[model samples]
Target chain A: SQKIEQNSEALNIQEGKTATLTCNYTNYSPAYLQWYRQDPGRGPVFLLLIRENEKEKRKERLKVTFDTTLKQSLFHITASQPADSATYLCAIHNTGRRALTFGSGTRLQVQP
Target chain B: GAGVSQSPSNKVTEKGKDVELRCDPISGHTALYWYRQSLGQGLEFLIYFQGNSAPDKSGLPSDRFSAERTGGSVSTLTIQRTQQEDSAVYLCASSLAGQDRTSWYEQFFGPGTRLTVL
Candidate 1:
């Protein structure tokens, strides 16, 4: 069976520090890898997307790196603030499927 | 400029009863999807609809779960004989390109309808 794993433990960081999250998957080759931000009681919002051929992607303060050889992706938030604190999820487009498969997500807490 | 919207922000039902959740996708969106998120769990794919083509029901967990998208816009996920395990946040998402795998369209999710089956 295919699996997408993320650190379930909440990451606590001081304000202005960089927050890094990891997503690992096995048994599937995804064409596109995406990151999303989800808040308590709210649905996830789209973030960054990196294609298999691409090694990295960036948007504003967010950056994502996709290493298909390692079957892992990293999400980084630079100059993080308290408002940036939320659960981050990683999704992948299964080769032939139109829907995305998402990881459980990692929660980040930024303290001021 | 409206995003995806789902009705009945919250629903509570008794076991063995049936419930229907609605999703209204963004105007001009040809793709729609249903997903379930359990407590402390990731989103589970439920169903997918693109254009006027036959929907892909491969993700539905059980026969008790069924969904329909009419006119390629609105969708309804119906759960019959609901069990306690059915309690979760049901999320609906939409994208512009349904069959364009090359495009890799990002999904826009709705606020979600939390279902509590007792």
Candidate 2:
């Protein structure tokens, strides 16, 4: 069976420090991967999407690296703030299906 | 400019009873999906609908779970003889691409319907 996993432990960091999250998968080749932010009671919001063809992607303060050979993706938030705190989920599009399989997610807390 | 929407923000039902959860996709989004999230867990894909074609019900956990999308717009997920294990937050998502198109877009999710089975 296909599986996706993220670090189960909650991460706490001081404000202005970098926060990194990891996602690993096995038993499937994903055409693309997506990252999302979820709050306590709300649905997940899309963050970034990296295709298999791309090794890395970035936004203003966010960066994602994909190593298909390793079946792992690293998500980094630079200059993190209190508002950037949330649970981050990693989703991969199954090569044979349209549905996405998501990891359990890692929670990050930025303290001021 | 509206996003996906699901009705009954929260639902509490007795075991063995039936419940219907509704979802209204965005105006022009032709792809709709249903997912469930348990306590402190990742979202589980339940079903997907594209246009008016046959839905992909592969992800439904059991026969007690069924869903329908009518007129390519509204969708209803029906659970019969619900069990306590069925309690979770049901999420609905939509994207702009129709089934005919090969290119896909990011899915916009709704607030979700929190179902509590007692």
- Which run of 10 residues does model 2 chain B get worst, by summed lDDT? B96-105
Candidate 2 per-residue lDDT, tens place, A61-90, comes to 999999999999999999999999999999
Q: What is the clash count for each candidate, in the order shown?
A: 0, 0
Model 2 regions more than 4 Å off? B98-103
How far out, in Å, is residue B115 in model 1? 0.5
Error of 2 at A101 (Å): 0.6
Worst 10 residues of 1 chain B by lDDT: B96-105
Give every candidate's TM-score on chain A: 0.98, 0.97
Over 4 Å off in model 1, which ranges?
B98-104
Q: What is the interface RMSD of each candidate, in Å?
A: 0.5, 0.9
lDDT of 2: 0.91
Which prediction has the highest DockQ against the true structure?
A: 1
